[model samples]
Target: MRDLLAITKAIADESRLRAVGLLDGRELCLCQIVEVLGLAPSTVSRHMAILGQARLVESRKQGRWAYFRLTEDDAPAEVHDALAMVLASLKRDKQAKADQKTLKAVLKIEPEELCRRQSDCKC
Candidate 1:
């Protein structure tokens, strides 16, 4: 019960929840996730670490990028299932919809373009 609470606390942040929700349909590179969330790499990585520690997300390194996804081992059957339901049940606001659309646009670009776009971005 305590562990479950801790996991919930970690994911309680809106940014983290958004990140988790995006993990629903596809695996995302750190760069992609950072762009989607419009957060500093370190900030995004920290949120991911919290999620990873809470068994709410999983990570793997590929070349120069760290990719994330919803993995089987990340959560128990019931917990994972519940989180999925919760994510689906939540209302996606106009801002969220717009953010998703922006993410999709950025995803269509090459990694080089992504890196270039993020080169000077502090957050």
Candidate 2:
């Protein structure tokens, strides 16, 4: 029960919540999350830690890149329902809406520049 409450508390922050919503289904690299969350890699990493401890998200490491994705493990059924409702309603959120705008803007970079800019820091 303590762990459950702690996990929920960790994800309870609006920023962390937004981060989860951003990567709900899609796998996302740290750089992309940085671009979307507008938060530093360190901060994002902490969010991921809490989320992972809660079993709400999973991480994948490939070479220098680490991708994060939503998971369906260990959470109460309510968490799943909450996530589903959030995903369905999330599109209407101002933060998510703004995040999409930023991502689209980022897509215009050249290949080398994108790689350099994207860097795949695996945050």
Q: All models: lDDT?
A: 0.74, 0.69
Q: Stretches of candidate 2 above 4 Å error? A: 73-78, 105-115, 118-123
The digit string of per-residue lDDT tens for model 1 on 1-123 reads 765875777768878878876777788887888888888888888899988877778899877778898756546765676567646744455555666787789779876567667854332
Q: Judge candidate 1 against the unseen true structure and give its global Cα lDDT, from 0 to 1.
A: 0.74
Clash pairs detected, candidate 2: none
All candidates: TM-score:
0.83, 0.75
Clashes of 1: 0
Per-residue error at 75 for model 1, in Å?
2.9
Worst 10 residues of 2 by lDDT: 114-123
Which number leads on TM-score? 1
